[model samples]
Target: MPRFEELDVWKKAARLSADLYKSMAELKDFGFRDQITRAGLSIPSNIAEGYERATDKEIANFLNYAKGSAGELRTQIYIGMDIGYIEHETGKCWLIQAEEISKMLHGLIKSVRSRTS
Candidate 1:
């Protein structure tokens, strides 16, 4: 198995999570900030957990979780933008990154599944 830290998708997801945390540091809306940050954090965390699993099936399952979290994060970003919590440009960039991360997770899951079959 490969190290999750070495994966580009993991790196990007981690960065995005960090960026979200930093960007939201000043926001007074604790509920919104907490939910968004938690969703952002889950993406990379799930990827790492998946990569650490012993079986290909487990890994693929975790990757699916990560992909789902990416979608969750993107949804929160959209809501944030709509509510004026997130700056339009910053939210737009995050949306793109989340989508790309989801794609990367999908590719990784396919690769793992191929190895199984």
Candidate 2:
């Protein structure tokens, strides 16, 4: 299997992480800064970490963690928007990206699990 860095989903997630970081940086005083940014960072980092492990079960487990992080980021984004720290449209875009990344991670995990089984 190609390295996790070589995986398209991982690449996209990384790019999304960068984008999210840039977005959050503008809202430095946002109430959920630490939690939201960390969750966003964790999603792709976990994917890469799990992929580097190179074991199907390990990768799947990491992917699940990535998905969970995505969910956490999404919720935090909503909170930021609700509290007026983030623009509604900007928060929506981030939420959508998180959802997309989560689904992609889930699909990758399912594929890995099936191949191993």
Model 2: per-residue Cα lDDT at residue 111: 95
The candidate maximizing lDDT is: 1
Off by over 4 Å in 2: 26-31
The per-prediction CA RMSD against the true structure, in angstroms, equals 0.6, 1.5
1-117: candidate 2 lDDT, tens digit per residue: 888888877887788778777877866575567677788889889988888885789989999999999888888888889989879988888888888888888899889999989
After the best TM-score superposition of candidate 1, give how far the Cα of residue 42 lies from its true spot, in angstroms. Answer: 0.3
Candidate 1 structure quality by residue, lDDT tens digits, 27-71 = 999999999999999999999998888999999999999999999
TM-score of 1: 0.98
